[model samples]
Target chain A: MNPVKVIINKELKVIFNSLLFYIAFTVFFCTTGFIYWLSQGNIFYTGQASLGYLFTVFNGVLFFLIPALTMKSISTEKRDGTFQLLFSKPIKTWQLLAGKFFAILIQVLLCLALTLPYYITIACLGHVDHAVGFCGYLGLIFTTGCYISIGIFVSSLTSNPLIAFFSTFAITIWFQFLFEMLSSWLGNTFIASVFMYLSVNDHFDTISRGIIDSKDIVYFISIISLFLALARYVICKSRI
Target chain B: MNVIVKDLTKIFDYQKAVDSLSFEAKKGEILGLLGPYGAGKSTTLKMLAGLLRPNQGSIHFDNYTYEKNESKIKKLIGYLPEKNPLYDAISVTDFLFYMAKLYDIPRYKVTSRVLDMISLCGLENEKHKLIKELSKGYRQRLGIAQALIHDPEVVLLDEPTTGLDPNQTFGIREIIKTLGQEKTVILGSHILSEIENTCDQVMIMSKGQIMAQGTTAELRQAPNSDFSLKIVIKGGEIPAIQEALNQLPQIKSLQLQHKQEFEVHCTPGQEIERAIFELCKDNDWYITEMTPVQMRLEDIFRKVTQKQ
Candidate 1:
């Protein structure tokens, strides 16, 4: 087997064996379901056939949920000294990072796949815009991928899972909110546009609006790869 | 895999963890790194295992060095770090299989290798169980099994038996001694008995530097071997034995331990047992007690570490 496959197998096995993934799966869909169906600002109250509120609220729920799913992937390894064991093998640091990233992605993907019933139910209820819904799900996946990368990077920086969690939450929220706020505060200058282009929400909003701009696609891909690269950098530099 | 480490240095925050550490280890022999805590044993092993990049110098295993062919060198070496970190959530067999695959063993060989390791590490009973369920000793066995899953030519063990009970230590030592017969095993530990019983060649380190390097016998000879042999000659003339011992040039100092009992301090690299027997036979003395002084490792450790 490839080194990356070996690591991915162990990490995925752990996710399946542990209660964390199950708990995250349960809590995520439950809250998203209750908010979209039972709350005062629910789909029934909005009286809209489109899943605009559903996707928007799901993004809010995932903002916290994805970090919870990924916070322990790298931090616990460092805490248990498995990081040393991993590097001792015939594998590069990037292989380990990639394996972990894919493991978190698989877990998140499974949880999202389970939410398909909600999409099907909403479609049955009324005429939902299928293209917009597809783009919305795509945006969620990309946004979650970027969040998972940040979570893995923060986890690599410290051995404490709790620290990894808070830092992931703080930095990701900052990445989502702080850049947009700065861009607005700076007015419509080219510099402000750059910050706007870098904000995760900006690209997510663009794709979720049924417009697949190449620039927004590049932004999401670049941020996900950037944070993964940052994770690789920290792990390699610490050995020196 | 023959190994040579020259001027290998690792500095952590301006403190030299390993300073100009140099040693040679031949294939199919155990080279024990004997040192106290903070003596840089782990650091040196880390560098050799390619886990930690050295600040300076070269490590040549066959022809592989840290600067070049690092990944290939990594494939050829296996390391079990201190504390023996393992995936507690996974079964022992699965963990070994994962390690075997990471080492890029042929797909067909992984199953046989995992099974071979299971029996080799004496972990047959726990093979299907979660690693968290095993005792510390069994976990250590699993750790060693993973390290050897790839059958690397070089195996570096860092304090492999420091925390185990006597029984577990014995099991681990037996495994390592067996490996020593076929692999270039570099074991690091502060435990003297572990090193003494398991390693043929020893490198004693202190404060990030090797203080003594050679076979234990060669190292033991360094403190001048000023050891006294107490001989109790029953009914033998004390003056006669003293005169005979005094005549021998090997005796550095002599004293009367008791009536008919003599203590002789022989210089290093000298054999005086035959001479004493010759004197006793000549005098027809019935010798009751003759005890040769033994060199203790604690004394050598102190002498080397203390620079005395």
Candidate 2:
């Protein structure tokens, strides 16, 4: 097997064996399930038989969940000195980062898959726009990928998991809301447009609305790649 | 493979950790790096293992250099760091299998290789145990097992037996000696006896520079060229024995050790033993005991390292 696959398998096994995985999985499922059904402005209140509200709520839930899942990816390895063990193999720095990236992505995807019951209920109630629903899931996957990449990059910067967690949360919060907020405050300027474009919320919004623009896809991919590249660079520089 | 390191240097925060160190180890040779703490032994081994990049100079394993063939070079090296970091949550078998896979060992052979390492490191009983539950000696054995699981041509071990008991240290040294028969093995430690027992070529390092380098016998012979002998005689007056020993030119210095025993420092390359036997025979003094005291590596290590 290749080094990336070996790393991913080890990572997944470790994640599954830990109590943290069960806790994160339970909390994410319960919170998203409760908000979609029992909370105010729930499906029954709108009575629209659409997943639009659920997707919006999911965006917020995932903003926090992704960071929690990815906070220990690289930081724990650094702190425990297992980075030496991994790098001693024939694996390149990017392959290691990519392995961790996909492993966390797989975990988040598993959590998202559990919400299929909500989708089933909505589809049973009335006609659902399948295109928007598909796009919404795609948008969630893209957004989760971007968040994990950013989290891994932050995790590489420090050996403390708490610091990795908080810094990732801080940075994702800026991308999720602060950028859009700043863009709105500085209305109609060139820098404002740049901030608007950088905001993850705007691109996710565009993709979830059933408008599969190349620009949105490019934006998400670029952010993921950029952060992963930065993570690789950080690991390489730290070794020296 | 022959491993050659030339003018290798590593600077940390403007302080040299390994200062232009150079050496070579041929295949089937064990090179021991002996140094005190902070003498850069670990740093040198790390650079050789490709865990750290050197600030200058180069390393070549056979025809391969790290610059153009880092992955290739890595594939040929098995390194156990000083701290021996491992995944505490994983079982020993799983960890070994994972390392085998990482090194791209053939899938069909990984199980057999893992089994080989488990038995070789004497970790048979602990193979199913979580690493966190094992004692430090077992953990160290597991560390070495993982490093050797891939069967790399070059093995770099940093203080492989730092905290083990005498038995465990002996086991590890035996394993190292076995590896030295077929691989280019570089063992780093500050323990003089361990190095003296296992290394074919010994390098004593101080302040990031090599203070002495040669075979154990050669190094032992280099400094303190004089050899000593302990002799015990009976049925002769102490003054007469002392006078007879003092008359011999080979006896440089003599100290009365006990009632009838004397410690004699002899000049090198002389027939001092025969001369003492002949003198005792002629004087009617029976030689009760005679034993030569060889110079030890410890004395040389102390003398060279403390020179700074």
Candidate 3:
């Protein structure tokens, strides 16, 4: 079997067997249901039951849950001394890193797949543009990928899962919010542009709104690549 | 296939762990790297295993050099670190299978090979259980199983039997002996008795350098030196015994150990047994036993390490 498949299978098995995954899944479903119900009641701003809006809210929930799921991908291995076990094998460093990255990505994809009923309900209730909904799901997955990369990088930093989660959460929030704050004070167009572009929120927002801009796609891919590369470098240096 | 290490040195920070240590392990021979704590045994093993790049030195297996061909070197050797790091979540069978995969073993043969290894290491009962649930001994067996899963030619086991009980230690020693029959094994440990019991040739190391390297017999029996003999006799007169032994020009020094025992350290150019028999023939000293005191590993180690 391919080594990545070996890692993916192991990660997926752990993610499925874990109680935290079930808890996250249950809470995610409950909040999505509540949000869908609230939108149905026509709250402020003439709330419409759009799949795109549900996806937007779901993305916000994922900002917490996805990190919770991925924080242990590498951290647990190091804590349990399994990372060293893998290194002693004849496998190369890149194969191991890619295996872990894809394994976490598979879990995120599974959790995202469970939310399909929300999209189906939106289609039944109102005129939901299928292409826009599809694009929104794609954008959510891309954002989840970016979050997973950051989570992996954080996991590489420490062997404690709690520390991994909090550090990743803190860094992701900084990337999402600090850039906009910087844009207001800097006033320079180039500086503001750089800050906005660096923010994952900015790119995710554009892609989720059905505009498949090449730059946004490139940005998410680059973020995934850069963080994963950084994770590989950190792990190698740490001699794990 | 002899393995050669020349000027092997590994330093961490300012501490020199292994300094210019050199040795060789001949084919089908177990070279025991004996040393106390912080004596650079593990560092030398790591350098040989290609896990740590040496600050200076080169390791060559027959014709292939470690620095020039790492992949080939790695392919030829298996290393068991002091800490038997195994995946706790995976079963013994799966871990061995994973090792086989890493070594690029054929897929069709992985199952049977894993089974053979499982049985070889006496891991049949715990083969299906996760490694974390197994006892320390079983975990160690699992570690050895993985090390030999690929069947590497040179296996460097660092304290393989560290935490094992007597029974488990014997089992591991048997496994190692079986491996040593066909493969070159370099085992490092501070246990002098284990090395003396298992290894054919021993290398006593200290202070990041090898103090001595030779077989037990070769080390103890220094050439051109007086042979020491400890004799057991049924009670006898001390003056008469001393006079009889002192008559021989070869017997330079003699001392009584106890009521019935005596030790004779002879000068150069003395055949000890001939002189003792001739003395006993002329003067009737009933010799109950005559045995040569063989040097133990402890004595050899102390002598070599304490020397300048």
Descending-lDDT candidate ranking:
2, 1, 3
Q: What is the TM-score of chain A alone in each candidate?
A: 0.95, 0.98, 0.92
> What is the lDDT for A193 in model 1?
90
* TM-score of every model versus the real structure: 0.92, 0.93, 0.88
Error of 3 at B257 (Å): 5.9
TM-score order of candidates, top first: 2, 1, 3
**If chain B of candidate 2 is superposed on the true chain B, what is its TM-score?**
0.88
lDDT of 1 by residue, B44-67 (tens): 998888888888988999888878
Error of 2 at B119 (Å): 2.1
Q: Give the distance in Å from residue B286's predicted Cα in candidate 2 to where it truly belongs.
A: 7.8
Candidate 3 lDDT by residue in tens digits, A1-240: 677777676666656756877888889878766765655542224556566567767788888887787788788877876665566566666788788888877777777788887777767777878788878888889888888889988999899999999999998887667887898678878999899888877887787778899999999999999999999898877751
Tens digit of per-residue lDDT, candidate 2, span B137-173: 9999999998999899999999999999999899999
> Which DockQ values do the candidates obtain, in the order shown?
0.79, 0.75, 0.36
Higher-ranked by TM-score: 1 or 2: 2
- Looking at every candidate separately, what fraction of the true A–B Cα contacts under 8 Å does it contain? 0.91, 0.82, 0.28
Worst 10 residues of 3 chain B by lDDT: B219-228
**Which candidate, 1 or 2, has the higher lDDT?**
2
Off by over 4 Å in 1: A189-191, B233-264, B269-287
Q: List the residue pairs that clash in candidate 2.
A: none
